[model samples]
Target: MNDRENLCLLHSKDLLDQKRLFLLFKRLAGQHSVSIAKNIHETIKEFNSATFTEDQKLFEDLYKIAATIENKVIDVDVLKQGVNKLLDNRKTIPQPKPEDLCVNDSVFQNKILSKENNQKTAPVPAVYDMLSLLYLTTNEKQRQQHFHDLTKYYYRQLKDHLKQLSIELDEILPLPVYEKKIKDFIPNAKLEVILHYLNQDAKEDTFTSELIQELYLYVLYPKINIEDCFKIAKEVVGIDYNFLSYELVEANGLLGALGQYYKLKLTINKAGDDVVLNLFAKFMIDFPKDAFPGGEDAFPKVGDAFPKDEPPTLSLQEEFVYTIFVPELKNIGLGNICDFLPRCYFMRSSDVMVFEDLTYSDYEAVNSEEPYSYEMLLLVVKKLAKMHACSLLYEEITSKGSGETTKINVQFSKYVMGFSQAVDTKFKDTIHYCNVNTTVNYVYNQFPDVAKEITMEEFRERSRDIFDSMLDKMKTSGKYRNVICHGDIWGGNILFKFEGTRPVDCSLVDYQMIRYCPPAQDLMAFLYINTDKNTRTNYLSKLINDYYTEMSTIFKRYSFDLSTVYPYEVFMDSCEYMKSYAVCQAAAYYPSSLDRKKVQDLLGSIEKTVRFFAVDKTEVLKVLMKHDWIRSRFREIVEDLYDLCLQK
Candidate 1:
């Protein structure tokens, strides 16, 4: 009757809680804002009275959606006409006052409905149908989560409730309407609920209950409208009808066939609802482009569309992600992509590889106790330097476009975060790969030798200070217009196009973890991940030399003074400060070599630095004095970090 009571429907949970349910129904359905319809309260009450049992929120969310539909219209007459229909429909349903329900379930009435066991108690039996449609239309992840949330408490109660309503059909209604009405309420229920409710001999029960009759009517007398069926599919069920040139299941969004991919509970929906797939297309997720013969970097600018030479069945999505018809892995069409450059075999998903043209044992030796070769190490260093070069001059690289692309990218970060909760336990429960808690601790532990190395009590403060200092430097370099860099430049994407040891070109894939930061952040992280403590010590001098040579070459073309831009001392200082990234990466990625591709990807980075170079304490001081990039402002940061530990 009043506004406050109407809002209470949202808080009400039980079907028997008539007053609260109707009140919430009125508030949710009557208007877009809280304004009431002329007879909103009366209509809801009537609907509750006539319906076999009451369902509050389900009716309300549907009516609310319809009302939302009506409100978007500009014409008041049209809106009123729509509202009048909803009201009339509710009146046709029976209403049960609050006194009619089971009194003991008050607390239950205030909680949310169990979607699995929820009853469709509205007078219009179609109300239940609409609710089912809503459930079907929800995305797979959300649907699963809701399904999971409801499985424990109320599933059996909803099942039993359907049983009781079937028995009283004849006693409650006229003969002609009795059988039909009961069937409409609990159509297609299992036999036990029916026999128990009817309590009649199976032979004597020739006439089905109204709920059963509705099931038979639906099955034997199906609604037959071909055009309308498609509309029902696309609009009510949320299926897209767009067709690609080939059935690339990965890119196609396989409706529910994801059971076919790498195993997990993650099902690709053919439409938004049923896991049942249509014959026209195979629902999938490993993007067709990901499996294309070339890596994303090597894919030719305009010509890399799926090759037409193959018959309809062998598109890249089907060929790579699932199965292929090729004679061997090599014949699977990398040659079809480009013939000149040697492509390394690596799976970004599971980085296992064996190449037809590989010469160096180092690439294949990803499994060796020593994972890298001298030539492979050189390639890894060169790539790190190149990744840094991109970030160092991001604006100049992107200057050509109205807004040209820079290297920094984190489009996949959101997906990575989402995977922690929704993806399988294999990923979410991973100790190293996605453990945020482990990562923070790892960063806290590295460089403990320094006095006051950011106490645990002071971690947040230290992190803020470190990031602020780094950003401050970034602002001055290229004047706060730094190039975007790959935030996670670990060995996952460090392997290259090589004829064994002779690396033809370096390519980076899995752009999912990209970010913008100082150029040296990636370089330091590469050192941390690729080399051990021993190797880091041995190669610090040579590594520094390699980076300087590559960086200086890039800087010379841009007319910046390499000596002044990122000087040797500044690079070492950046390493000391940024080395925490290695700790974070190790915690997230270390123990996860379970998959072949993942192991190869990680070891590929490690191969660069596994040569066991010993650290020399004296070299650090000599390099600091000789290099000029460490500006006067940065002296305190280097001094504080250098004091953390002396090389043995």
Candidate 2:
């Protein structure tokens, strides 16, 4: 077309572009990157509606090219550069896109920086191409990696910006920065930087898409329903994220001995209530209908598959899993408190993987640089204090039975469901190939008599008694205060967030065993799982002191008297209880955490089990035995069965 006609077209398109820009801002506020890009393309077509001046047409052509950014918005900073090219002398405004930046990115680092900061970088077309493609992809984990590569997947992303907003970013952030940056369009990008940090703080293998989705929605749309995300999995998601699988021993099959797996991507309005997305495990497909051939019997019939006589893998693997997302609920708005869980707790839940499920050790060995230490064990004590506080305030926060529902139907016994009782119940050959010479086996082997007396059946019976006792304590404790206890606060569940603000700031997990009970339950349970020599001597007392100190911190918010509960004597009582449970919990779990070879031998070491418990039991009983009248108390606890059963 002629210059005059083109000029007319350019002017008309500019007007249309102005209107569209406002809408783009609106979509950005909603964090709608895809929709925003589509609208921008529509606005660029306005250039074709009218004629333009020679100079105007040239500018309009640039606008048409910029409109092609159909995945993410033109880093307004980039657009500002084109604006300068159009109006040659206007250099004062911050240029969203600079001509010198790499507009084209083959690896996508530039596009990520653009999306991350909502601005331009070295203008290179290769960068744009890679990002544009990633935008179109359907994977979340892959998308996150693409974004992460730009920042080297560390807190280094805008680290300088983080320090600048030191006070705000230093604390745990409520959401990811990329989502926040696109919203509100604020001048200070502090929130955006903080968002990146929150993402970095999460361990990669531990990163579940459900947590990411849940956090994003909860922080942004307070009213979104969780049902919308029930079906979301690795194949679905809008945000570009990548699964981080740590090196692990893989069992063959479509399911590679599922330990911690993941999926990731972005979203449009993919959120449910509280804007948080569930991540632990996805919904398991329908049984039989989706199972391998052989009608309903094709799949390994659920039972105690762990060769107790041989303990191939802990019988835990056979547990039927209904869902697969490792839950990491985020954006927990506890008003002023930054703790994510106060707002939401992580439940490694699956409809199919309920308590009545198959047996299997779902976890593998964690490479702890050092074994559990006094300092680390102390951190766990503090964790118990915090969880107990939350439980105590359960009634104040919500009416629902937070911990009771889960605990009521916990492992009542180790009965092999669906199988007949005629099977030779006890595993005969106790020594496993892996645990023969390990310290775990050696420690237990020292005392063969007591360990030999306790069989799997006996253990199950004892567990039932323990459960019954717990129910009674829960009832009595309810009159005082009950908090959500990590019913199984073993070393495996209490994670150490060593880098975050609260050095010992622990994030709990595996909530299947969550129970509504006294905080003492959590304190005892965690100590039972992690307590050892140096822990008992050098750190135990001081740790209890620290827990009280931390308790005071949480209590100050609710005006609680520290002395009324958790006194030195109460703590001592609690410690004795925790010690008693050590033999039971350790026997079942040591195999999963210790170096595999050593861990296995220890599990089948009945000789060691008897000996270890003998010493442990004596020490534990010594504390309670101080009161010569304790035998009667024990009899009452064991015999008053109905009173001990969980009421809820």
Candidate 3:
């Protein structure tokens, strides 16, 4: 076919497809609307003579029917008729005697009567009156006019409310008024129609449908008069609805799970534009009490499980990084790295940390297995050097009492050196699982005969011993000199900004594990967790040299001798000593670092750490075996640790 003919044929096919889709949607919408109308009618008929005892069952049935109608488009006329019939039946039912009324009914009656006395004597038509006028009228033109007028009324009500709140309405543009009239109105009209239609009826079905439709419209169309709904809601409930806007985006629950995660996007209007905020909220409301195989509690309190005076809480550590460490880094002319850290706006009710999103700023997080180029690695190493140098300078400045400084007391060693009972438990469980699992066997089988000579048991024992020594070293401010180490320096924690394929800048995050430890802890963690076997083998020396050189330059700028503070020899020794710990961390975290899917799955799991190891073990083991450089590195570390154990 000719190019013009092919283009014409494609356009015709697209048009036909769109028409088919529109017809299908229209048919489905009509069927759903009729179904919902019938269900509403049946429910109301069944509940017409229902006693107070059957009220709960009536609402439950209505709730199920309402849930089915969600996301389905309905005919306005059918919905109006169903609602009016229900309302008429509700009015015909005999009212309960004063003595027969429940406590809730009596309280509601008194509250309404008191409200009526305080307000104006003139009776206003309820929302049902407006909906009936819009729907039942025979003139299509009049119905359309009524819909437009009703929308304008709601917007005016929102404006009045805003004015009452002492907000300047002139500065804040009202929906439908500020934007293109026809374009904005079309999308928002459906929600305004639904809300006005469903408002006066107090039935569970009506209220739920209204709420669901409002939430749907609020998210899909930003120009909806959501503030008016909030105002009306507050007046009806007699309590302050202080929040601006909240809409749930994702929700998942597992049976018998201790926790649940809810992802929500909130809209807060400040200045002129709306600021959309994304939040992931976790609730640890339930506990199994005897979840473990031996009838031990899975979730234990710090005081019950550990003897530490101060437990390392994620909130406390994050707050410290936000309020203290970030400012210090910026002060030392290392603002580039600080830009990567998630800006904590505030801690809401202790558990929720509202962070300024970097995704919107074009900073993308690299996935697991996405190879970091030399330039990208260089950028990260330079930032790490600046951060470490700043830490040294901060300590020196604080000691001299030249200005206000945060008291450094929460050492990384105190938290990681068997101090956190949770970490200690996870460590034991992970090692035990690795020792017994076939995944490890598969990995060992792939290694050379010489490497395989070290039995799994011996490997396990050597790993444990190395971890102990490393912990002891981490706990003390030893001869190697301590600086602020990004306790969790993995691929997942690092975010990079790129100009096409080239990395321009980088940032470090997840500061809950921040600790005062040897800088090698951060360096090794990054190398082992981020780099492939080949990259590590080829560039490890150069990277280390560059890191020391950058650190030296930064120290000199701050008027401190790099040798007196942290010498090149000491840094190398620390890296060598911490090699075993790096390998162990790599084994534990490598699976999660490989992909976003793994990270999300791990986050959602009940036994997060255990489940992460179980799911990722085989994948990580395969990576370790397949890559010659990685396999060699692992074998070398194991042998070095084994020799040291033998010497001891």
TM-score of each: 0.32, 0.36, 0.54
Instruction: Tell me the lDDT of model 2 at 95.
Output: 38
**Model 2 C-alpha lDDT versus the unseen true structure:** 0.33
What lDDT would each prediction earn against the true structure? 0.33, 0.33, 0.47
> Candidate 1: lDDT over CA atoms?
0.33
For model 2, the stretches where C-alpha displacement exceeds 4 angstroms are 1-260, 263-369, 396-481, 499-504, 565-572, 596-648
Query: Which ten contiguous residues of candidate 3 have the minimum total lDDT?
Result: 99-108
Q: Which candidate ranks first by TM-score, i.e. highest?
A: 3
Query: What is the per-residue lDDT of model 2 for residues 1-648, given as tens digits with 9 covering 90 to 100?
Result: 332222121111132232332332222222222222223223221111011122444344334433443343344445435344423322232433221112222122233334544554432222223223222221333333233332122223223333443422223221232222222221112112223323333222112222233233333322222222322322244443333211112121111111322221223343442222323331222222222223333233325643232222122212211121111111122223323122121122122121211012122222332346666666666666655654333333332334433221122122112111112322211111112222123323332333233543443345455533433443224233444444555555555555333344455544434434456656654554454433445665676677768877876776555566445566566555444343334333343432333332442333333332222233223343344333332322222221222221
lDDT of 1 at 236: 24
lDDT of 3 by residue, 339-366 (tens): 4455654332223344544555677677
Best by lDDT: 3
Candidate no. 1 TM-score? 0.32
| RMSD, every candidate, angstroms | 22.6, 21.2, 17.7
